[model samples]
Target chain A: MNKKIKDEDIKVILNSMDFDIPSEIDAKVNEMIYSENLPAGFFKKLLRTSNPFIKWVPAFASILLLITLGLIQLNRNAPERKPLSEIKIEYELKDKNIKIIWVKKENFLLRRLKK
Target chain B: MTLPLFFAGEREITEKYSNKEVIISFNKFFIPEKKALYNFILKSVSFSEDSNDIYQNTALRAFKYFRKFDTSKRFKPWVFSIALNEIRKYFKNKIQSSDIHSIENSYEQIPDTQNRELAEAVYSAAYSLKNTEREIFFLFYDSGFNISEISEITGKTQGNIKVILSNARKRVKSFLGSKK
Candidate 1:
């Protein structure tokens, strides 16, 4: 038998039907959410605590770690400097003699010019 | 010097608040709907204990994936999708165990109506439906979901939902008429 049921009639029937909502459901769902949302491991627990100072600890540690790594890399890549005492300054007498001769020649030329 | 162990403890304490926040928000949004959700599950499963278990499982699943939930979209259809999946899983497990008779026994235990013949007829007709049809029927009529919302929850095309809803209403009407 084909009977036409109006959408309103169906809604009325469905709404009129009564079902008990288990009283413990709210508590149970809350408990489930609590248990499921718990921080999974040590790091997760550390990141989500309520204390203000405590909450910044991960951020601090991360920044400190980055600084430490940067310093290590900077130290590794830096050129080694020689100690002042170990640095040798050599005077090549040959070049010194050449310079002296040039000066002597200039002086002689000046003297000749004056004469 | 700050000891490494002390620093680790501080990090643990700090990290816990985000999880706490998620739980707080979940409680705020979900607690208000718990009764409605429980009633829906109860009607869908037609057994208190099964409904309770499914409800708990659904809540747990929802919590586990709560971060993935989009804030812009409505929470109702998303949560209902999870509950519907749990229902399917429950029945699949039951059938695999060859415990189909338990379903029949649970149906027999549906509470008797309080002298409302029409209500009783409607109730029986709703339960007589196949699980998918029953879900669509309830989602549309009782839960106030529109066709698109039903499609989103069930992953069915709108056309398929319309067809199923049409068939479900036909069955209900015929059953009610015969009962009269």
Candidate 2:
């Protein structure tokens, strides 16, 4: 006679086959962990202000902030460009198509036309 | 069993020295896996004493390196990998000594007759597998780890795990088939 087994049967059979865990296993592990006063973790070291990493973090952040602020300051330092309608640009026609263009505020003379 | 999203939103908790919170999260993450972890160690190492030592070492090492555990991945495979390494290290030492342990064979007999019989049958079927195949089999049925997770734990390719598991399954089926 051919007999077949299913996964469910295996699962049930296997799960039921577990060994009795020694009771002291938990206590021993607990004692071991507690002895360390709990692990502070690897990344936890960075949280310490005493760590070298903390010193550089502020410096990096300040550098980034300064760069952003400097960019803004540099932009501010640039003369505000007047809109086309705001500033007057004057052009005097010397000939049919030849003209001199200059900002109205500045006096510039077109002395000689290049040959 | 799956872990709670321990590092969600409050990553600083892990990166800080908050002992109480860290302890709670660690316990929450590790407690449910305890029995399974112990059983795996027990099945892998001979002698209850040595198994206990391996078990303690695996747990202690895991705790000491808890921060190194990636929060995004499954904890089962990570812990399983550590347990496997510990078992290997034990065996390597045993091999040098000439005579120490041959992969744990002690079983505490169960009281109930029907369950005991089933346990014996399952044990026989499981033991019929090759060493690596047997490890995969236990990880599959006992811990419910999928192929990918078992691959990660065992450091075998997923394709290799599938082939090994399939062959192991055929053997187990044949073992069960023969019993009829």
Candidate 3:
């Protein structure tokens, strides 16, 4: 019991199918191939001479490291500038120089604010 | 460069690679076939610009990898396999880049409007197919690659290629039907 479609149907469909080959593309193709050959040849030689780990692994590792370093630097630098405590300042008359204080308590306020 | 004694056909590869005549001959072998290979890839991907890129890259890949290729076997399929690999790579890149060229359209669809409207429409429709199905479709029917040859080119089992082709035929017919 075969259920294949009609041959005529296939012919109709296939006939309607058309392929376009742009003439301008030929020159471009030639250029692309020549250009590709240079890189491929270079890479092939590089692969042959270079250590496998150095060839494939280090590139990825370097990228991962850059990303890791970027994130670490981001974390370390961004959050630390906004400190939690209100200002606590102290001033004293020492060596004939006046120093003032500013802090949490009201009595500590003069110590905190008497700058 | 470390010259290895073990590249079994290193002599042939090196000889042909260095000799301008052999390289030219190898290129000549591809010149006539270029249009056909171009058509095979173009019909599936159906981008005029990308087709050219694929064709050129395929040729370069074929040239570079010709050494690992079996010298005794017919060169067309071997070289085409290399081209096909490059085309897949091209599509992978296209997909990665978020390009609008779809791997989902039918093989028969082409660009809209112009003297080549119908032709382009059909071509674009074919271009719309999934990458796998389109490849098998074009390889088997358009490029006249047989099942085994396509399997060899694609690294799929012949049975798997047959199934893909079956699905492609169905999808193409339906796509054409909706257009009508």
Assess each prediction's global lDDT (C-alpha) against the native.
0.72, 0.71, 0.64
Error of 2 at B27 (Å): 1.3
- Candidate 1 Cα errors over 4 Å, as ranges: A1-5, A18-20, A35-115, B1-17, B105-115
For model 3, the superposed segments whose C-alpha errors exceed 4 Å read A1-115, B1-17, B101-121
Q: What is the TM-score of each candidate against the true structure?
A: 0.63, 0.62, 0.58
lDDT of 3 by residue, B72-135 (tens): 6777788778778888888788779887555444433443434244444345555667888877
Candidate number of the best lDDT: 1
Angstrom error at residue B153, model 1: 0.4
lDDT of 2 at B99: 51
- Model 3 residue A9 lDDT? 39
* lDDT at position A30, candidate 2: 85
The per-prediction tally of clashing pairs is: 15, 0, 35
Candidate 3 structure lDDT: 0.64
Measured by DockQ, the strongest candidate is: 2
Ranked by DockQ from best down, the candidates are 2, 1, 3
Count clashing residue pairs in model 3: 35
List model 3 lDDT by residue over A1-115, tens digit each: 1124343534344444555556677666556545543653553563353333335567899899999999998888554565445667788989889887756644555675876
**Candidate 1, residues B53-72: lDDT per residue as tens digits?**
89888888777666557667
lDDT tens digits by residue: candidate 2, A13-33: 766657666778788788766
